[model samples]
Target: MAATAEKVKRGRKFAQVLEGARQVFLRDGYEGANVDEIAREAGVSKATLYNYFPDKRLLFLEVAKAECQRQADEAVEFDDGSAPPDRVLFAAGRRIADFVVSDFGQGVFRICVAESDRFPEIGQEFYRSGPGLVRRRLADYLREAVARGDLEIDDIDLAADQFAELCKADIQTRRVFRLPGCRSGETLDRIVRGAVEMFMARYGVKKGQTKA
Candidate 1:
């Protein structure tokens, strides 16, 4: 969320390598991604790729960090106006759900879990940049919604967490394990909409349609 986490040697091919890494990492995941594929995707030689990123793990970490930053930057803050709570929450839920099911998002979580024993800070940093940031911003939005009489919640933070969890219902775990046919577009739409409906039932002052 701050500066790029990894300190790889940078050169003309730095961005090129990263772009290739991003594609391969997102396509095949960290363990499945081969260095040669990344190099080929980036149109660089193996020696050039190694020169920029000595360790494949570091390269993956850098990609994960960039992803988190990208999500943070793209996250919407609905504090400036009176966007309907239902619409706002649905948008947030959709964004979260989409990322959670995405290959990049899966990679970020997997790397954090796999490296937790060796590098605890990696997990912590991911939390700060990813889930933690989402919770904070969502809580802020919920607090404002309550003030606007759009929602009824005793605990904004808890509500934020609940909504986030609701978005992942029956989606994250299945997708994480690569279960077949778990990522149908229609199925994801149902899950995200269901999450918003449940949250609104609990907190919405007046239930409203969240369908797009």
Candidate 2:
């Protein structure tokens, strides 16, 4: 139908706008990015840009959501319970830690923190779309693991939160502050392995053991 075609076109245009907005935001930060530049970069007219996003804050929120969703889609994949708990946790933890320290991730986080006071909503949206989303997904995985007798978690949600925090450990803070010394793969792997070991120490169940 004509309406369906129009909707498809609009969705494509929206995706284009989001990609352009991401680039602008990453380069200029939220306070410095300009709508005109975003519109130009997206190859859309100013009117079209405005029509898609009513205000800069909403546009930025959408961009953050898209970025977070993309990361989740690519990195967080333990839903089907296909892999062993150790392997799943390590993969998920490493992915999260790497993303939190990546340039794009750091930029988005800095923008949220810098704009938090004036634009608290931006911070809230970022948390909801990023870390919060990841935590919830991890909690679901933990719950499933518990049901399978692989983990003996009494509080899956809290365990998920703890595991996430442990994975980040010192790396996230150092990266956020732009501290010296690059994190090599070995260092990251070591951190993730330690986190998994610590988690297993508390929640992991040996074979033939019942859930705690």
Candidate 3:
């Protein structure tokens, strides 16, 4: 009973500290935020914060992880009804494009890029939370399409990676550098549509094209 209670207490304590750290990181950014301030905001002693996170770098990494996870969760709900596989790809690409160009996505990108070099593990964590999972999800969908005869690809995993790259276009660079008036929405639509069509032409079974 005592051990169980202790575990629950520690879990709650970690949650509280994580929430506080996110607010501090968002307000002051990774470079400006301090451990003591985070601890104070979390209603824990500096020692307590250390007991949970060990260092500010790890704490910030966790914050990025949480943000990416939230975005990935949102990707779960994209129902564009039954359509041509490539057309569906275009729609999914545009949805992700809008999200990446949004204010919240830009903020997450900034935080991750600013802190990624300082703590390389944080980069891995962020990738796992976002792009890594996205790639895996795409691969799974492609494999399913293959089974259903909707698409044809020799290597599902590689195809999935290429598909995601098709979606990304130059959006990341535009967002990171804050390029003046980057194309989004319908403009993004044209770019992603072209890219998806090109990708499908290369990998997917074209209409009337013989399967290799």
Candidate 4:
């Protein structure tokens, strides 16, 4: 168990280094970023960074994983048990929207798009973190709703991803591009409300009733 515990600690440290590398790379770009800088940012030694990651490319991938975990942790929620499905989804949507609209979110997304041609691995990792996490959590929620009889989903996972796409598509893209006049309190509210209505229209069913 000591070996296992040590491995876990090392893995966590590596993950932190990756996260630091990602932030620095996103802010400074690939050529400008350095492993030593990443180590300093992550509070690890240069030797430690190399102990976990042999190259900058691997560190970048790790960074993507860390970011994904953060977003996944933030966007997914436990059922309050009292609120309706739409309410729960809306709450989750709001959390996602808030993140997408932030400066750091935009920076990271920009890095993914800009660097995709040069670093396909990083691009894929970014996709896995952003869209991948969203889909997984949404699917899990939909499956739960199905079990609870709030929804009648034959394909819970796909339904969850689609639901998240519907909720986030506009805000996410616009925010990614830093579009002008693309958002306001009213806009976010409308987006959430519209997404909830659309989702319920498709998957929601009267309790205990099978799909028509």
Q: Which pairs of residues clash in candidate 3, taking residues 3 or more apart in a chain or in different chains?
A: none
What alpha-carbon RMSD in Å does predicted model 1 have with respect to the real structure?
A: 4.5
List candidate 3 segments past 4 Å from native: 1-28, 34-62, 76-82, 209-212
lDDT of 3 by residue, 7-57 (tens): 222455888898899888876779999888999999998988888776676
The C-alpha TM-scores of every prediction are 0.81, 0.77, 0.70, 0.68
Ranking by TM-score: 1, 2, 3, 4
TM-score of 4: 0.68
| Clashing pairs for predicted structure model 4, backbone only | none
lDDT of 4 by residue, 1-212 (tens): 11222322256676677667877987887767877788888899998888886667656655665666666566566474677888888887766666667776777777777777876766676566666776677777777777777888898777876776776768887776678754677777788778888888898896666654
Error of 4 at 171 (Å): 2.4
Q: Model 3's lDDT to the true fold?
A: 0.72
Clashes of each: 0, 0, 0, 0
Residue 120's lDDT in candidate 1: 74
Leading candidate by TM-score? 1
- CA deviation > 4 Å runs, candidate 1: 1-7, 25-34, 206-212
User: Where does candidate 2 stray beyond 4 Å?
Assistant: 1-17, 35-58, 68-72, 207-212
Total clashing pairs in model 1 = 0
Q: Which RMSD does model 2 reach against the true structure?
A: 4.9
